[model samples]
Target: MYEYVRNPSLIHEGPLSKARLPVFLVHDGGGTAFSYHLLDRINRPLWGIENAKLQDGGWWDGGVPAMAAHYIELLGKVMPEGGDILLGGWSMGGLLSLEMAHQIALTAREAKNREGEAGDSGASTPKAPIFRVRGMIFIDSIFPLRLAELVGPLPEEPVFLSAEESRKMKLKDKVNLNMTHARMMVRFWQVPQWKDIPVPPTILMRAKEFVSRDSDENFVDYTRDLRLLGWDQYNEDHGHFIRDLWEVNGHHFSIFDIKYLDDVTRKVRKAADKLDPPDF
Candidate 1:
């Protein structure tokens, strides 16, 4: 794994008001997270985590597991008296949030084990607070491991990128760091059996349309199937993990537009409110 100092910086910090717990949002493949600032912050503080190498002149040397481990440690200090927190991520960030939640659960397990050992010595369970995952919001994240199962093996052409995306990507090709983050994303495909960890309530928001003028002919054709954008089989085979499937107002890329992003933020807060425990 590529080693770096305490660099994957936390980019956002909210009010000290513990009245409504904070939400930590992770960055997607492009590796920056400022867009989350657009989220509605009615009663919550929003925090963002971004890859240091992408912006700070280094590179992510490892895979998702390593990334998760590093971020969890940072969060442990950043929110020491950890309490319930809502987790949200866009695209690749969604998969990241799940891994993070699993990591948090691991910490809880370790805490429980320590208390067990103390109890044997006639001591009570520790009351120290630790971070807990209250809920998750996935903005069109499709885990790698499930892609094959959801859509069958993809064709050789892949058709993963639309014309607009292809055009934007050509520009990024000139930047080495962009390619680095792209490569890092490929390593996130494998599924880890995070056994024994509870699945927090989740909501997945998808785009209303899929298209672009410059999109490949194959991609344009692929869009016709819709499958509601590859969600039909998912709802049938893996619906249990997600509590709700939200078809938002914009397409995958446009979901972040101020107009639609506001809706996304509002719904996230509403859902988080229901899942998060009362601060009392």
Candidate 2:
């Protein structure tokens, strides 16, 4: 049923158990899910969504919405029926997760409306399974210009590989993967497209180190910017989907570094617990 996942190599399965919600993580701009290997110790079922663009070479045209739609379809097949799952991503993946959550919400609402209409008309319709996104976790994800403006400028250095490092690494495929996702990300932010969707409860894990020197000099902080963006607005308006900010040691890319793996895992575990308390 999950035909979209043509490349099984993309998914890294961790320990599975019915006692806890499975966490689905999207890859960063580079489109590699391996970066999240450090999180494997969380001891809950973990699945990483790889960059299908690399496998199918068809992601260039649709932008973020299309990407989200594709993943939503794949997720529906993989996730347990009526189970609330945790969705998240790092960097560009984080942005993708948010978009996916929005699309999921829209889908659920439409499904509910259809069921209501069917009942009113006395028509018997088979109900489709609903996919529930319990919460969202963004690891240094990007936002719209309205939010970016508050943080001032960010660093231009490549998060996955530096220019010199790319040459030394001699991994053209990886480089191309990064560029492809970066282009999509740029296209996504070209206009303020996302609007008026119910966002789920979210946790923003911020890297304490600045992305670049200028941000350090200017004292610009993305976490601070997120706060200014009125993250609490959703909670105030709907009494749900409250946003929480957490500061971790390292830069955007380094947060996944081995030295900080424990911290990252702990924070993710905490977020998961908050979203779905353990059955024990």
- The number of the candidate with the highest TM-score is 2
* Residue pairs of candidate 2 with colliding backbone atoms: none
Candidate 2's residue-wise lDDT over 143-198, tens digit each? Answer: 54454344334344323445565556544566464545555455445431335655
Best by lDDT: 2
TM-score of 1: 0.71
Q: Over 4 Å off in model 1, which ranges?
A: 1-18, 56-59, 121-129, 146-176, 179-184, 216-239, 277-280
lDDT of 2 at 125: 73
Say what the RMSD of model 1 is: 7.6
True-structure lDDT of candidate 1: 0.61
Question: What tens digits encode model 1's per-residue C-alpha lDDT throughout 149-232?
Answer: 333233332123345654565434423344344434444445444555656777776666665756531232243245334534
